[model samples]
Structures are given as C-alpha cells and as structure tokens.
Target: MIEVEHLSKRYGSAPAIKDVTFSVEKGEILGFLGPNGAGKTTTMRILTGYLPATSGTARIAGFDVHEDSMAVRKHIGYLPETPPLYPDMTVEGFLHFVARIKGVAAGDRANRVQSAIQRCNLQERRQTLIRKLSKGFRQRVGIAQAIVHDPPAIILDEPTVGLDPRQIIEVRNLIKSLAGEHTIILSTHILPEVSMTCNRVAIINRGEVVATNTPEELLQQLTEGTGYELEVEGNIVNLTTYLQRLAGVRGVEQLSNQYLPEHRHKLRISLEPGQDLGRNIAAIVVKSGLGLYEMRRVQASLEDVFLELTTEEKPIDAEKTIHTEPAVDSASPASDSVVEAAQTTPTTSPTLVPESTHPSGGEDA
Candidate 1:
C-alpha cells in the first residue's frame, strides 16, 4: 500500500512537481502518466526515498518515506529509468548481492535469488554474466535484482524503455503478473501499455495532477459517453431534428456523403454520458422507412484523454472535473477522500551507491 499527500518539490525557485497526490492500492498497478517535464521521475524519486519532499508526506506500508527512509526502502523495490547492475556479476550472483544489500536473510538468499530469476524468466541467463547478456536480458536482470528481496511495493520508471517489441510485451506481461501481489507504480510514455497493464491511471501535466481514475472512467469523462456513426439512404431532411428530440441524444452532425450514391447520407450522433440508444436509433430508422446500411459505435480512447488533459495551458482541478474514487488512507483504512495535490520536494540525500563503485550502476532506491 502507498499513500502520498500534498507532496511538492522545488529546485531553487523552480518547482518540478507541485501538489501531486495519488495512491496505489495493495495488489494494484497504477499507471503514472505524463508528458515530458511533467515531474513523473521527480515523484518516483521522492516515493523511493531517493529524494525528500519539501512539504507533504508519503508513506509505504505504513512508514513515512522521509522520517523512516530505511524502513521505507526495505518495504519497496525500485527500478529507476536505468537499472542498477553489476556488469561483471552473473545474473544469480548479482541478485544474491542485491538480496544481501536489501537485508534479505542470508539463509534465504539462495531461494529468493532463484525465485526472482524464475519470475523474470532468466533461467537461461542465471549463469551468464550481465555484461554478456543482451539489452532485454540485461533489463530482466535489472528487474530480477529489484524483486530479489520480494518487497511488497515496486516503483518502476520506464521499465520497458529501450526493449524491442517482443521484449516489451514480455516485460509488460511480467509486470502484470506481479500485480495482485505487489503494489506497483508504472511510469511510461507508451499509452497502449498503460491501457493494457494498469487498473487505474493518474495523468499529470505541468507539475500538477489533472486527473486520476480508471481508464474507462477517464474516457467517459472526456467524451461524456460513446457515440455512433450511421449510413442510411432515405428522406433525411428531418432526420437530424427527429434524432435530436430523442432522450440522451446530445447532437447529430451530418458527415459529407459526396462520394456515396445520391440520397445516401452519413450521420454522427453524440450521446449523453452513460446513454446507449443504438436499439432505439435502429427502430426509428426502420419506422421512418430509411434503409440503414451501417452503424458503428465510437468511443474516446486513452490517447484522447491524455492529450486533452495535458495539452491544456491551464492546470485542471481534478476534483472538480474528473470522477475519482475515494482514496483510502493506508494509515486509516476507514478514512476516504479524493486525491489532492501532492508533489515532491527537493532535498539532498546520500546516493545509494558510492562514487568509487560502478559509476554507471543504476540505483535500486
């Protein structure tokens, strides 16, 4: 479980994330979506205890990320944009090393390493050196190290960034499999992956959270509902007026039928939220003596929602516009409230690795 509230982060006078807030329910995968420079990585770093918030608070498994950084780290497994890895170490050896560093019991290290290897589909590469592995395998090794300790929470930032298409699907499936057992926050630029892998999504723009809800709910909010496109042949002079009078009908627009045979017309009908009038439309067309050639349903997509929310020059008050489920407080399960502004604060913390060690090594913060 994870809870973040009124978290903000600023560098000098510039803020990277302002009043950003959202929660990941236990066993749920929340997609953290945003355009470039929208403070996604900033938020991830703060949650992982790799950075501290200037204000607000974030808790993982009931421990404050800032006040109890060590405990929070123990409860979370993080995979930064670049995975922390030891190029010279074999997949199993690196996992063992990570397990030790993450405080896994020495007696259980072998089992944990093997489990991580299998979970990440690294059986063949278990004995292969990380440097000798391909990019996909290296990525798997990164994930394996992150889960080697089996932490309850996982923070993955661009986990599938550079992998090939097949590799991307493999990683996506791997992430989905981890859901129900680990609370995950996945940040990526791939919209389709989010739609397929996430149970809910939080869209951020210009350092502020614009909307947070299920993908379907967000789509509904944007389109107000689905619509239909119809192709018919008949007297259409009063068709628009007749359809407009129907319950739940928002508007009807005639699409150009220049290429169609004479008397054939195309119409696009918009409907109010939660309304489905396909049957009624068909019945009316038949009763009116119109020959209905085609009828197709149209709905808003995640890409549409993302563009609509992020392209606005002004910040949107998520509570006032979008429908969001009550966020449960990890500290108090009975308390429910809408997610509000929470952002990361800029604070210096000790790096997870020493400068003398692998300089290119990623940090599993």
Candidate 2:
C-alpha cells in the first residue's frame, strides 16, 4: 500500500506541487493523470526517496520515504521515464546485475532474474544485447529490472512515452498483469491509459490535485448525464423552445444543416442527471407533426470529464471540491530545476538510488 499526504515540493521560490494527497490500496493500480509540468514526476520522485518533499510525508508499505529512505527503497521498485540500461549488457545479464544490487541473495538471484524475464515476455531476446534491442524491448527490459528484486510496490513514470500504438498496448497489458501482485502508481499524460488500465484516477492540474475517484464515479459526478441526438423532418421554427420547456431537458441546440436535406433538421438535446426523456421526446415529436427519422443516445466520455476539469477556472461542486489555481507554465525554470536535480543526482549506491536515474536525460513528459 502507498500513502501520500499534503506532499508539497518547491524549487527556490516557486512551488512545483502543493497540498497533494492520495492513496493506493494493496493490489490496486492508481493512475496519476496529469498534463506535462503538473508535478507528476516530482511527486513520483519524492515517493521513491530520490527527492525529498518540502513538507508533508509519503509512505510505502508503512515505511516513511524521507525518514526511512533505505527501507522504502527496498520495499518499492522504480522506473523513470527513460529506462536505465547498460548498452553492452545482455537482457539476462542486466537483470541479474540489478537483482544483485537490489540485495537479492546469491541463491535467489537466478530465480528472480528468470521470473522477471518471463513476466516481461523477453525470452527470445534474453541473450540479446540491450543496445541491439528495439525501443519496445528496451522498455520491457526496464520493467524486468524493476520487478527483478520482487518489491511489493512499483512506480512508473510515463512507461509508454514514445512507443507505437502496438507497443503501447503491449506495455499497458504488462502493467495490468502486475496489478494484483504489486501495488502500482502509473504516472501518465495519456487519457486512455487511466480509463483502460487503472481502477482509480487522480487528476492533477496547476500543482494541485483537482479530483480523485474512479473513472465512472468522476464522470457521473462532474458531468451532466446522457443526452440525445435526433434527426427530424418538419416545419420546426419553435422546436427548440418546446424541447427546452420539457421537464428534465437541460438545453437543445440545432446542428449545422449544410449536409442535411431541405426541411430536415438535426438537433442535440442535453439532459439533466438521472433523467430519461426518450419516450416523451418521441411522443412530443409525433404530436407536433414532425417525422422523427433518427434518435441516438450520447454518453459522456472520460475526455469530456478531463477537459471540463482542466479548462475551467471555477471549482466544480462534486464529491471532491475541484481545486483551482493560477496556471503555471510547465516549461518555466522553476520546474526545470527540480527535474534537473533529480536527473543529475549521483547513483553511487544502487540501493540508495534507482538504477541510472537519468539514463536518457530527456525532458519530462
């Protein structure tokens, strides 16, 4: 299990993350969903004990990340945005090296390395050199090294940054498969990753946690319920006025008629939460002498929820009061310094620092 409370981080005078709070239950995959420069990586680094928070605390498997950094490191596995690898080492050799550095006993090193190789599906390439492998396989090698020590918790920051669609799906499936056995915190800007892979999501914006809940619960709580789209043929001058007056109807808009036939109009109806007016709408259209040609339901999507929460300036009234703050450009020097410090930190001791913390030295996702 993982717990974070009021975890704040700052670089000089500017704040990177403020009052951030969330938790992950055992065997659950939590998606830390946010845009670039939203302090996702900052939080991940602090939780992994690679960086210390300005205030508050983080605990993994009941050990404090700051006060008990060594114990926390032993209990969790970490993968930075770029996979840290030895270009000359074979896949099996690399995992074995990582296992030994992670304190795996000499007797258990072989079994742990094999298990990591099998779980990451790198059998054929086990003997291949890391530099010779494709980017996708290299990513699998990254994950294999993370699990090689058999830690109870794993932290991944942007695991599928540059992979193609097929590779992304493969990596996604691999992360999903590790859910029950290991608690995971997947940090990503990709929307589909959260809805498809995580059981719960925490949406962060402007250095603050905006909302936290399951995908379905957040959609239902923050958005207007389902609506309808209809195509009708009639003399419909006051159709919108009538529809707007109907109970449970929130609003109605006439769509573009550019492609529609003459005298045929397309309309979209917005509905209040928990309201179903399909039967009433049909009956009213018939009574009004309009020939209803088509009617279809439109459900709210995760994209809709994400846009609404991030783009708005006012707080949304819901189970979790949406937090709002002045927008801070993610590319500012303040944020860059924190990232630079994490990347440039020494890795003299593998147990104290994750393997090759800044292998690629690329910008944060």
Candidate 3:
C-alpha cells in the first residue's frame, strides 16, 4: 500500500517532477513509466528517502515517508538502477551480508538468506562470486538482496536493464511471482515490461503524471478508434471512391503502390469507433470486380497510448479513459533540462541500503 499526493521536486528553478500523484494497492505492481528526464528517477528517489521532495507527501504501508523516514525504510526494499553489490563477495556471502545490513535478526538470517536465494533462482550460484557471475546472474543477485530481509514493499528501478531475452523473461516471471506477497513499484522505460508485468501503469511526461490506469483501459482510451487494413487487386481508383462513400467510413489511405502489376494493392480504411465496416467494404470491393486479398481489424496498443501522450504539447483530453491526474499542472510546457542533465552526468556506483528497524545487522555467515 503506497500513496503519493501532489509530489513536486525542483532542481534550482528547473522542476524535475511537479504535482505528481498516484497510488498502489497492496499486492499490486505499479509500473512507473516516462521518457528520459521525465522525473521518474527523481520521483523514485523522493519515495526512497534518498532525496526529499520540494512539496507533497508519500506514505508506505501507512507510515509517512518524510515524517517517519526510518520507519518507512523498514517496510521497503529498494534497488536503485544500479544494484549495490560488492564484486568480491560470493552470492550467498553477499546476501548474508545484505540480510544483516537490512536488520534481519541473527536467528532468522539463515532462513531469510536461503529463501531469497531460492526465490531468485540463485541456489546453484550461491557459491559463485558476484564478480564471476554474468550480468543476468548479477541482476538476480541484486533482486535477491532486495527481498532478503523480507520487506513488505519492494522498489526496483530498471531490474532487467541489459539482460538477454531468456534472462528478461526469467526475471519478469520472478517479479510476477512476488506480486501477491509484495507491493512493488517498478520504474522502467521498457513498455513491454509494464504491459506484461504490472497491474496498473502511471505514464509521466515532462515531470507530470499524464495518465494513470490499467494497461487495457489506457489502450482503449487513447486508441484512435479502430479500422481495417485491406490488400486488394485491380482498379484501385474505383474501390477507393466507393469505400470512401460507405456509411461509417471516416477516411481511406493507400498503403502500397498500385503501379506494380505483380503485387496486390494495400489500402487502409479508417472507420469511426464502434463501426464494423469490414462486411460492407468487402461487398463493395467484390461487387466492383476487385479481388480482396486480405483484410483485418487494426487494434489499438499500449505503445500508441505512450507515444501520443509523451509527444503531445498539451495533455490528451481528460475525458479519455486515461485522464491526466488533476493535481499536476497540465498546461506547463515540458521541461527538457532534466533529460539533458541526466544524459550529460555520469552514473554513480550502487550501494547496499540497510534499514534501521531491527536492533542490529545479522551475524556474519
């Protein structure tokens, strides 16, 4: 359970994120998405207590992140974009070290470490040094450490940044498995990750939350209605003129060249929302003596929603299922300063974060 209200952060006069707001229910995995310099990292930093917000409030498991920093840290497991790892330490050794630092009790450390290893599929590699492991294994090691102390909420930023396809799927499945037991806020630029892994999505652009809704709802909301793509042969001019006159047909655009005799001509027919123009279009093409090669509906996708929102100068009409959160200022011009700074700056090394809730770090393995 997490809630952020009217969150804003400013680097000097330039705003990194402004009036951003969203919530995640218990057992829900929320995907935080945005383009480069869209205040994603800034927002995450504020939530983690690594950086403070200029204004607004963030609470984790009912504890205020700003007012009760230490208590809030106790309930959250954080993995920055770069995982904090000691290269020389063995897998089991590193997890044991992290468990202790995260305040796992001495008696419970062994079980906690073992569970993390098993959950992250690090059982066989437990004896391998982190330096010797591949990037994928190293990422698994990073995730293992986050859950080692068994925190209720986990914050993972770019958990699968550079892994191969197989490894990506493995890590995706692993994150999915943690859903019911943990409340996760996954921040990544990868759209597929959000579509496949998250329960809901929050699309932030220019330091503001432009859209917040389920992936399905966002897709339908932002979709430019529906239409059909057709591959037809023979007299294209007559077919185009005929289809354009059909009821419910909004427009028609030719997608392929008609000059080539060997290839069939491709035409995209646009239709109003909720219109089924396939049956009527087919009859017209056949009646006019043109051979219809192929026809299929063009469904809306998440990538469509993402590009439209991020690229637009003004926020999309709020009436769409995906409305911009009212708290954020929608009229302000998007700031590119944050994006430029992130690109020019070098990334810092990762650190193993230890919470202060427990009496002390666990004993050494």
Q: After superposition on all CA atoms, what RMSD does each candidate show versus the true structure?
A: 15.8, 16.8, 15.9
Candidate 3 residue-wise lDDT, 1-365, digit = tens: 89999999776676778899999999999999888778787778788888878899999999999999998888999987778999999999999999898889999999999999999999899999899999899999999988999989999988999999999999999999999899999998898999999999999998899999999888766767367878887756655655665666787776645454564777777677666656566766766577888887777777778888889664543121211223322232221222233233343332111000111121000
- Window of ten residues with lowest summed lDDT in model 1: 336-345
User: Any runs in candidate 3 off by more than 4 Å, and if so which?
Assistant: 256-263, 313-365
Native-referenced Cα lDDT, model 3: 0.79
User: Could you give me the TM-score of model 1 versus the true structure?
Assistant: 0.77
lDDT of 2 by residue, 45-157 (tens): 89988777899988999999988999999999899898999999999999999999999999999999999999999999999999999999999999998899999999999
Error of 3 at 98 (Å): 0.9
TM-score list, all predictions: 0.77, 0.83, 0.82
Candidate 2 clashes: the total is: 0
lDDT of each: 0.78, 0.81, 0.79
Candidate 2 stretches with Cα past 4 Å from truth are 257-264, 313-365
Q: Which parts of model 1 are misplaced by more than 4 Å?
A: 220-222, 232-238, 254-266, 283-291, 313-365
lDDT by residue (tens digit), candidate 1, 234-323: 876445545655666787767778788999988878777766667666665665568999997777788878877888554343212212
Number of the predicted model whose lDDT against the real structure is largest: 2
Backbone clashes in each candidate structure, one number apiece?
15, 0, 1
Select the stronger candidate by TM-score from 1 and 2.
Answer: 2
